[model samples]
Target: MRSLSLSNLLRHHKHTAFGHDDSHLPRQVIEVAIDDSEDTHELPARKRRGRAQSTAGTIKGVIRRASLSLKGMVHVHRRPSVTAEPSDLNQQLPNGRPTSAHHTWNRLRHAAPFRRSRSVYGLNGTEDGLYEQQQLDHQMPIPAMGDEPPYIPMNTGAAAKASVALQNEYYNRQAMHTQWLQSASEDSNDRESGIGIVVTEPFMESGVSDDGSMLGQDSNISRIDFIKELPSELAIHVLAYLDAAALAKASVVSRHWNEVVRNQHIWRESCLREMTTTYATSEPVQPGAGLGIPEIAPSKNWRQIYRAKAELAQKWKEGKACPMYLNGHTDSIYCLQFDEYKIVSGSRDKTIRIWDMQTLECRLVIGPPEVVNAPNVLEDAEGNPTHYVNLSDSYKAAPSKPQVASFAEHHKASILCLQYDDEIMVTGSSDSTCIVYDVRNGYRPIRRLTHHTAAVLDLAFDDKHIVTCSKDISICVWDRATGALLRQLRGHTGPVNAVQMRGNTIVSCSGDFRVKLWNIDTGRNIREFVGHTKGLACSQFSEDGRYVASAGNDKVIRIWDANTGECVREMRAHDNLVRSLHIDSVSGRLISGSYDTDIKVWDMETGRQLLYFPRWHASWVLSAKSDYRRIVSTGQDPKILIMDFGADVENIEMLKSANTGIGGIRL
Candidate 1:
């Protein structure tokens, strides 16, 4: 395991982190270590021995064992004891030689990977033993033949001079360390005395079994998971060399491998190096506003979390998914969304249902409150609600509030679209209104938005604004806190079927065959996209507001560049009108639902269709949304379809803990 451990440690961090081939790391000492290793590793060990030839302590026992086991080869090429280099191995060492310090470094560097393969070694060609490296070393140019200049070409003048200088520096540092050790040792006699120098004979001679058949350890050594014999800290240090995939494979070898591989140190490094997550965002990040990679919570199980991320990614790539049906809604389901705890869906059954995410049990079923009529509400000739009470201060002062119309808990009509954050849930409906529910307080009705004249087709909200599009060919922007109409946008010549918001920008698709961008605050047109040959039913604005996506009667999805108002990509796969589309900004996948009864996932960047399901919904697929784990789609079918990418991922709950919010990825 020692040689296997050393090789993994070097290959993983050295070549992988410091990148030699495609890497420009100042520490390219690696490529030299494998192909042309000669200098740095040996200089320090040789220097220490030259200074205190007789002094020994902890190193004495180690050297004795190494001498017996390795038979004499260890001294020339490998680290036999504690090593100090010019500094770095970063600064102190020259030719990359694996140091005991490098091993510790492999531990430290891997100990805490931030969000950020192996060469199998040994005679067995498994990464668990160390025999063949002895044979492989002989293949390298035989160490130096007593100072015959050098094997690396010194034919070029500049190359020769530089090599000479580096060689000189190597000797100079070694001499300095030797002198320092000599000075330090002169005063100390407490260490092992140099008098009785003990040495041992090799286990085999004249082509005998070096497997230690003579010592009876042959059975033990052959079966040992070499890592088990080392101290706990040392074992962890050794295991750190293996990547997540390798660590997982090593765990099944034996109980000991399983135990050592579970070390918090090993997985912590793996998580940091491989795990990544994003902060909770109610909506896309606004311009000049962004969240950095979220730090993993220390309370979670990182190993299971790592595994789930790995498997889920593969599942998405291969279009492998497990399906579960949510069948509570009695009529066509129009919209749905899920978070860590629950799935909240709105349906044409005039109801809202929240399903427990894990058990698929109906947690709560709510619908429009019983209302006699819309109270004290008047409409203009165009049918827009004219008289709406600003009830914030009224409700705050008088805790017992009077009914604001017998309004929507509040959708009195079929709910069309909805969005929720931690505190409240907002639903739009054919009732020409939006209702806000206090999600934290038993789903109580709080505010009502009566700004649209026609059916509210879709809605999106952020911290400040609630944006809603309507079949009235108008879009209304409202203040989230006060429920006051902020701005009414009028541009689409036909009913605005879908709307999406990212920071200050809003994207809306209309039946008029046009897609437009608008500034939520200024209420002015930013740009317009016109590539669809027919009406657009659904649209999405990228998190950065640089791209817009829309689909409708044209039976295709067009990716638009918001700045240029140009359709950049026309992704065609649907056999009928595409109804709903969403982009998972975290994964860069475009999920679309269509009347064709198909839902397809696309690589938004490449404009290539990745996964497609023919008839995922039995009828017109109305809406679809996704995160890293699953895609949630609702359609003309009474049932909602959940394509759970994590269904087969073991210990999925642990993965959810790390995925605190949407758009987080662990790879």
Candidate 2:
């Protein structure tokens, strides 16, 4: 028969005493120790063989002994040694062997009757509620001194309510972690297990200890740095979606996140997205043109470039400007023209002065020329002829007609209007003639054609011809090569104020309140646009010659279809008469100056005002011109106002306006 040990009987009694179930316990094996020296001699060969065959019967005998009622056996096998150290603690017994400590604790702790208490584990007062309340306190957003209010996420249409719900949910999950820690601290029995154990379920009074391992895992997750674990490539890509303002704020999150966000590609893509598209032609100089700024470069710092544009726009919008005094012209400046290099202004002082834009120095002044004849010669000591003072005098036969002092005495009266190209500059004047100067050849007068009976008001030219409008109510088409009047246009009943020509089309505005489109070669009116109630001041044909824009004393600007003469749109833009107008086809911006002392920039297509400089001119702004760098305006005030909007602003305006309509988008 199999024999059982005292320890095994004690384990059986402990299970029964605690009312613990053991129905699923594994089958037990009973071991009987025999002296090794007498094992084979004591048993017969046949008896030993039979013992080996009865191994199965021995296992069944142990199970039958365990099946006996433990209450009957406890009286026989109850051992007090289990509470102390036993010699056979490591010895194997029937079923699994129970250690001494396991037997002692099982008997002492499990045998006691279960009791419910209001508190346990030394926490009986507010201390227990304090831990729970502190965990819940995390749900409130702490007020920070200057920090922006928290960005509460919204998951529904009721943003405020949804955000509150989300905020609560977020904090509750966070509170779960703290509650888990409190539960862990309250249970002294669990900590002895080790870090490998965790409790996932949240701490609740009902059964927090049941899933303590799960709760530990949930709490430990709060310590993970999620953003820090993302790959740098993905981190940067995520940051690229943030706007400039948010990106600056995110950089302060942490050192590791900051480092990932500082990746150049992230800022590059952001800068590129915010920046307007720039074209090479919009720049003052081509890349190799040897000018102040090149159109293209091998590399670029996108951040600085974008910042410069943003700052420039900010300053312009704020009307923050440092006025530059170009102290020159003694009298009111009547007409002005400028390129990137210099500003050529005509003043009532009867002089045309060129001022270097960069140096702000008067480069040169062209005034009426003086003619001096050679003095009469006197005989020197060696019989060589010399002048009375020193040099010899010379003489040539004079012409029959009284000649003007010099050919370059360009005007007898004030220069009224001007137009120029790279090679030549043409100026019209009250002298009743238009003079063409060779700008490449010392600015000397190349041709002087007398055609108008009164002061010339405006002029435009190309390589082949120069067209001039005058107060005499006529337009003269002149041959650029020779001082010959090619054709006379005489249809206007009033003085023509402004005129512009493109290819075969000539558009002119007159005091008759009419905008006439003329064929320059034939000197005949192709069409007429009549809309202004008062006299027209300026007119221009669009570059493609499909449309014409006109503005005048009517305090209105109108755009008309060139072919059909249909009035497309009209804008009442000024409180006073508009004096001059210009259009930039590339940017689609129309600029107008008025007697109101204001200069406005407009969108020609939509007739929407984009920007306006109010009282930018101390006096009436007579004429204004704009390009990539600046807008140069000269008026009844002698001082020239150069509004430097910074380089490449035209490109920015173009990009920002490209997709807009009336009441359009703005940067």
Candidate 3:
């Protein structure tokens, strides 16, 4: 009887272990227990049934051992369903314990035979375990109860093949990248074209687009993108070597390229390299000039500066400008100095006038000490007035202010030349004297230097000394503060027309048809630049002191190496005498003003004429000066024509009509 009872109990337990219905459980829990990975596993039905039977036996043994030998045996029981809802059944517990179905499912899931199959995959002839893992990796997660199961991929066979292809592709890509890095490391020039690696993938192929833009939709990845990926400093260093034209072209490559190209320091370097000769490093800041204007700032962005100057230069070359006539002087304008704000012009009328740049009104008139009207107006050999005639103005305008100060007692003759820095101004006169005025202290004459026997023709000064060249065929270097002559240089046989002093060097051009470089302190002629057949009217040392540019009565402009005294380039600039010359060191532009009334701009490097302003002045252009922004020229005409290269005047027809002689513009 005992044996029969044990046998019956064992049989009941065996049926309960594998035969109990799990249909009432929630769908999600059922799917988790036997996910699609299990379904896709291609095991024969007999094999699956055998494994299930073995799992049930193992659970039965575990339960029997627990009931007989363990101190606390755990048993699961289920309560009667409340609404026949599978979700409700999942939530409920029998006798306040885990459900029997959950316990049985877990026991069957972790059975020794089932675990062994999963642990060792594809070693034998079956695709059950390995296939399950690959499918699970790509499978959709199971849905909760009341939700339909998503389309779970059961492509175990296909996934296995794809896994092998993916491994092969990854290894091949790695090898290609390694080779590229090795080659790039060996030769740095290879990296300039950007790093390239040919990655061949079975799913992707390379192709081109219609617009020439890189269209890397699937394959054919562009290596140019790697340049954008470089660190900004390194990328800028690489691009710094490109000239302005190349850099401008590169800016249009892409949005990222444009953004990188606008970096401030990059343009700053280029500006310093190309425009160093023209832009002043130590110009003083003027009042009312720097109100949020970048050009007047202490450390302005070089890109903005370069663009403004380039545009102005283009306009100057084009001759697209309207004339502004400043009418105040009663005689020919002899010498002038100007900046952006004001034009200070001296005339043979025995007066100096300071004109406002914007309004064209004479701000202040500086006459001689006592107003003396000549009994007879001087006449030329042809009976025409030797002095200039005032340009006819239909509209009459008054001076803005009366003469600020008159020094008729100090200067007996016309003011020939003048220059001023921040603290002082020096003026040379036909009275054979030079006057140093204290600009910081009410513009009063501080020193009256008298030594020259003939009229002072031109003068140059620094803080320490004043250099004066005269019709007496001599040059005088004087101590500016003491009004004492320091050294007298007697070299030119004819009157010296122009002189420029830079540091210890003084360069003078004379009517003797010679240009000389001298040491101002020692009174020694450093070198003589001799090539012109006619008298040299103007000369200037370049900003770097490497070259000297001079123009003369011969109507030719010559550039000489200051060190070698070699005539490097010569160009016939004007039909008449070339009276004045200015070297725009920042732009490498040589500006020549001529008695022919033409103001021409030339390329200093090639001696090629860049622009020809025919009849820029109504009469002989006596003196001209320029800053980066504008050019102010004075002539035998009473009006001081301010040719504002900065002006935005556009006239294509005027530019075409201006070319008269000199083979047109070189570029």
Candidate 4:
């Protein structure tokens, strides 16, 4: 029970009564305690009287490590019974043989990780017939790959037949140990230190000393920590291959290994190389790249950072999240977008609602000014005046609905699409028009662009131009500052469903089964991407505007090269039409919502479906967006579902710049 170091234990083990000459031999004695109730009748002669002539005179139950005698079979020497003949010993009844020895050797044999094959130890042979008897002393078959040295010994001897008893004795002792384990398996630890043996099972497994022996005290061989002896830089390089789990195990090997595991070099490799998302602490910064902001914490702990990333990645991989519902929308939500502070959604109910991120309350609502602010329902409210009890409280009437609503300045039809930045907010409607408002100026109306003759299905804008696609088979571009119609891009035979603008490039997908690229300034059709067999519903430009991704009624997402019009990647997973697709380049992930009522996440680069969320909406999913911490989606079920995957991470704001596109998960 004492806390002793390996050095003190080895010192005591070395000073055991063996003389200098005997101690120089290869094998040393290990003391094994014999169970009191052990049956000695089955064994040849089970008692040791006096080793006065030998070195074991002071110890009572000391047994030498099993060795091969002169015969080809193992010849174990036990108590010297003067009455028993060598030949008669073989005929002795096999009843009550010590199974403890068999259990130990069998355990060590199967457990040695194959340092020595069963053939070398005659383990494959029975007590009746020694099939692969050891003829040479200590010599074994060559070590196999991934196995280490200090090969376990096998039977040896041609002169001695009954002496094959050493292996049997070893087998006998191990058998009893196996019996003890079985009977005491119900113990809390499943360990039988009830005998007070100093060598516990874990100690025997992990406590090997310098020479790879049970106790290297008596052996003349010297061993050193070659890993520690390596140059410090090389040591870090070697430790890099051991992942987080292996590194944890290696840390306790010694103080040297612990320090190496704690070194910044080790964790820096994990954060920069192993992690998919870039850590703010290690990422390189470029001018005007504000996202490359440093961590808010004064000092960084690389190890803690890696641990956090690993845990969060696992949560995403497992599709683990907590859900919060926004239940205001009365009809199918056609389009929505959000930043870190609030969520804005437009629905078929002819209203646009703004929800606060923290309070989850609708802060503002925009609807038609001429119509009464009342929900259109088939329910007979007059007949329901005498309503009875409902199925549950959840089916009861609404208790707290928004009291005030703002009338839309221009939209007379359903608000279908919207986008916003710091300066202005833009909303497109089935009225075939787009209304721009000062986002920071109390939602003040800026101007209206009514160039399209049909429903404005989708819209995208940058600093220079507002791009809108329509059901009238037209794509219109307007100056953001002047409200001037810049270009009327028309090429598709069918109505364009989605449009995205980035710098000089504009990408659009139409119901005519074509995805096209355009030069915003000249209104020239740069290229057309041809892949989908059915109408396309959505399209977007990559961060660099070099690649385009589109999805639609075909239920597949295709990525294309803008310059060559070549289909570069196709992601196929959804069973029904994929209605929406959003590419987050920072995280390198594609967020998808399907008409099958599912929202799925994909690795854009690998085209692998990392995972999908469980069904939370009863109707078609219309839109979905994801960041590092959360994924927000809406459906025809008229519910807004916000699932927060990284809700537990405290400093999650650090991940705002880079995306988790390559984040690894267990799936």
The numbered model that scores best in TM-score is 4
What would the TM-scores of all predictions be? 0.56, 0.52, 0.56, 0.58
Q: Which digits, one per residue and each the tens of the lDDT, describe model 4 over residues 568-605?
A: 78888588998989877656678889888888888877
lDDT of 1 by residue, 1-667 (tens): 3344333444544343425242442233333233332222344777756634553554543433332233223222332112333342333324553434434333222221211111111111112212112122112212122222242432577544543443343344344333222321222211221211111112111111212111212233444435656788988887777779789666644456777888777876666555443222344322112121223555666676566667778888999887766654668988887776567888886777666565555555576444222231223356643322222223211111112223334676888998887777899999998888777666678888897888999998998988999999999999989999999999889999998888788888899998888998899997888678998888887766667888899898888877888778888868889888888776678898889898899988889989998876789999898876788889998777888887777776564432322211111
Please report, as a residue range, the 10-residue window in candidate 1 with the lowest summed lDDT: 114-123
**Listing every candidate in turn, what is its Cα RMSD in Å to the true structure after a full C-alpha superposition?**
22.4, 21.9, 20.7, 14.6
lDDT for 4 (candidate 4): 24
Q: Candidate 1: lDDT of 134?
A: 17
- Model 3 has an lDDT value of 0.60
Q: lDDT tens string, model 2, 1-667?
A: 1123323433433354336443445525222211112223245778766755764467654443333322222321223232434464444333343534344333322221221112222111121121110111123211111112443223445544543443343344444344344333443222222212223333222121111111112333444445566777777888887767667655644456667667666766776555433321243222223222223332444445445656665755554544454544556777888766667777665566665555455555565653112121112356543211101124311111111123545677787788766678888887888778777665677778786899998888888988898999999988888868889998999999999987788999899999998888788888988778999888877656767889989899998988899999899999999998877653466789999999998887799888888987778878877654467888887677777665334333221211211111111
Over all chains combined, what TM-score does candidate 4 have?
Answer: 0.58
In model 3, where do residues sit more than 4 Å from their true spots?
1-306, 372-399, 407-409, 649-667
Better of 2 and 4 by TM-score: 4
Native-referenced Cα lDDT, model 4 = 0.61
Per-residue lDDT of 1-667 in model 3, one digit per residue for the tens? 3223333333433344235344554554333333223321244768766755664666543443332221111111112233455664445332343444554334323322211111111111111111110113333222111222222235775544443443344344454344322222221112222323333322122211222233223234543454477899987877766657667755654557777788766775665455443432233222223211233234455566556545656776675654566765668989988754456788887776665554555555556545323322233345543222232445434333333466533576688899876567778888888877765554567778889998999998887988999999999998877878898999888989999988899999998899999998799998998899988889998877888998888888899988899999989888998988988765677888998999888888899998777886779999877655566788898778766555563321121111111111111
State the lDDT at 167 in candidate 3.
32
The local distance difference test score of each candidate is 0.62, 0.58, 0.60, 0.61
- In model 2, the Cα lDDT at residue 307 comes to 58
The clash count of every prediction, one per candidate, is 7, 13, 8, 36
